[model samples]
Target: MIVGVVSDTHDDQEAVAKAARLLLEQGAELVLHLGDIVAPFTLRRFSREGVKRLIAVYGNNCGERLGLLRTAESLGYEIHDWPHVVELAGRRIVMVHGKGPAGETRELVEALARSGRYDAVLYGHTHEVDVRRVGSTLVLNPGEACGCLTGRRTAAILDTETMEARVLEL
Candidate 1:
């Protein structure tokens, strides 16, 4: 199964739309957003035809939590708080925004990957692309889809069968 990973969209509709299209073209069956969506309108951009599901977590900048939840529910999407754990394609995965008052930093993300509790740990906050393996787990941060900080809009495609991921420039 191919899973698309994205993060820190930060309300860039153009980037979000492009990212979604690119992921779908890459044959992504599901798309995961690590958060910082910013607003409900930005969340709607994932409503593309080919995506089977869109799951997102709350980031530090997602102040309008209620609105995000409502929009997600209406779109038949799934939105959760930080550290959301789920199993996809028979692989255990944990998704987090990797920031906020809880101080979920890069260390925390690495720790989760090293713990061997999950097959992949996906996070974003620093808006930097990071893809590596810790023991038997994969730790990935798809960078900033908004291109606000890195000046490069990007996303990622993860192959569950091989447990490999590649960053794609949007």
Candidate 2:
């Protein structure tokens, strides 16, 4: 499976659209959005005019933005309300928004890995793309789609068959 990953799309419409377009052009079978999808229209517009199959977690910004989920729903995507688990290509993945603390991202993955509950962990908060293997599991972050902070819009592509991750700058 070709999985597309992105996070912290803090409401940059153009970058989000471009990222989704590239993912689709690459024939991504699934897209995992890490979080900080600021406004409803971010996801809403994507659903209406861009992406198709998207697995998204709500960010800290999302909690403060009311009715955003409803907007996304109306746009045709189901936003996962909290920590979610999904299976893809025989691999289990745990997804989170990553709002706990600085080093908590690693801790969360470590804890989850220790439980043997998942084969991969995906989270977003820090606007930095990272891919690391933790024991038997993969820890991945797709960075920020908005490009507000880093001045570069980015995303990730994970090839399940090879267990390889490629970062895409939009």
Candidate 3:
């Protein structure tokens, strides 16, 4: 399975579209948005070609939470809260928005991955791309799809069979 990872959209529809396109071109079957999505309408941009599943979590700036859920529901999708966990391809994966006091979120995410309780920990908030290994766990942050701050649009594609994460700059 090829999973697409995106974060910190910040309501930039254009960037989201580009990122989604890149993910699709790379053969992403599942797409995960780590938050900072901003508006419900932004979710529409991700409903593009060749995406099997679109999963998302709320970020610190998730305004109109209920509306977001409604939008997703209307589109036949679901948006979860932080620390969402699931087993995919026989591996436990933890998904989080990573919104909180500075280093605290990073520490918690790192701890969760280091505890060996998950095969991969996917998070976003800092708008900086990061990929690391903690024990047997893989920690990945796909950076900011909106590229509001860093000006570099990015995402990641994770190969479930090989546990490899490839960062994509759009």
Task: Encode model 1's per-residue lDDT on 1-170: one tens digit a residue.
Answer: 99999999999988988999999999998899999999998877678534558999999899999999999998989899989997988999999897643345887987898899999999999899999999999999999999999799999999999999999999
Task: Name the candidate that leads on TM-score.
Answer: 3
By lDDT, the better pick of 2 and 3 is: 3
lDDT, candidates in the order shown: 0.90, 0.79, 0.87
Per-prediction count of colliding residue pairs?
A: 0, 0, 0
Ranking by TM-score: 3, 1, 2
Please provide, for model 2 over 39-131, each residue's C-alpha lDDT reduced to its tens digit, 9 standing for 90 to 100.
877877677556877878888888644577677566666678658898889888888877677488767666776776778788888787778
Report how far residue 158 has shifted in candidate 1, in Å.
0.6
Give the C-alpha lDDT of model 2: 0.79
Clashing pairs in 3: none
Ranking, lDDT, top scorer first: 1, 3, 2
Residue 92 displacement in candidate 1 (angstroms): 0.2
RMSD of 3: 1.2
lDDT agreement of model 3 with the native: 0.87
Error of 2 at 168 (Å): 0.7
TM-score of 2: 0.89
